[model samples]
Target: MPATYNTDGAEDPDLYAQLMTERYGPLRLILAERNRPAPPRQARANLTPDPRAAEHRHQLLEALNNRPQPDPEPAA
Candidate 1:
């Protein structure tokens, strides 16, 4: 919650400005810029596949999907 006035009980302009700014700053920006243009995203076309990443992904998938390799053949 936020305070409506300062400790002195008077309509402190600074306090009012702060509270208003905190509560309405984001909204003011949104309303002021209806179009709200967003930054363009760059394509990762040049990024190369990481062999280690692929290997780790494969290991993780196998760990999740495969059962404990059945205890090796009984010692007998």
Candidate 2:
């Protein structure tokens, strides 16, 4: 049998949203969240920075810019 909604994969937001809500269920949230009001944001974070963030950033930059990088030293 032919597949239904073969071209209905996110190309058209309206159709995709309908299909998602129907095929999933009323309990399927986030679909209804489309173009809706912004959910409340947290006032502040209780998070700490990862010590390796700098290293990861340098590695990502080098990879994206097509360059090799030396090991990153600890930040002051």
Candidate 3:
């Protein structure tokens, strides 16, 4: 974006005015002079849990309750 002011130390209102006029045109300007707030963010819930989800949760709870185990032996 260009600097909002000119080098001569004047606010470049004319540049933005021209840009808005060209981009939106005068009719749109007359209809709505201001912007509206953006739509709210939407969140979707997980519809179905995985079949193995319960088993995985149980395993996690058991691991948390028990003493820390050594790393498993690497595969051959």
| lDDT (10s digit) by residue, model 2, range 1-76 | 1223344447786687567558865432544455478989998895888899999999998898886668899999
TM-score of each: 0.29, 0.31, 0.30
lDDT per residue as tens, model 1, 1-67: 2333233553777676677668667545645576677789786675777769988999999988886
- Residue 3, candidate 2: C-alpha displacement in angstroms: 53
Q: Which candidate is the best by TM-score?
A: 2
lDDT of 3 by residue, 1-76 (tens): 2323222443676776676667667644444544555678757777877999999999999989897779999999
lDDT of 2: 0.66
Error of 1 at 28 (Å): 13
The full ranking of all candidates by TM-score, starting with the best, is: 2, 3, 1
Worst 10 residues of 3 by lDDT: 1-10
Which of 1 and 2 is the better model by lDDT? Answer: 2
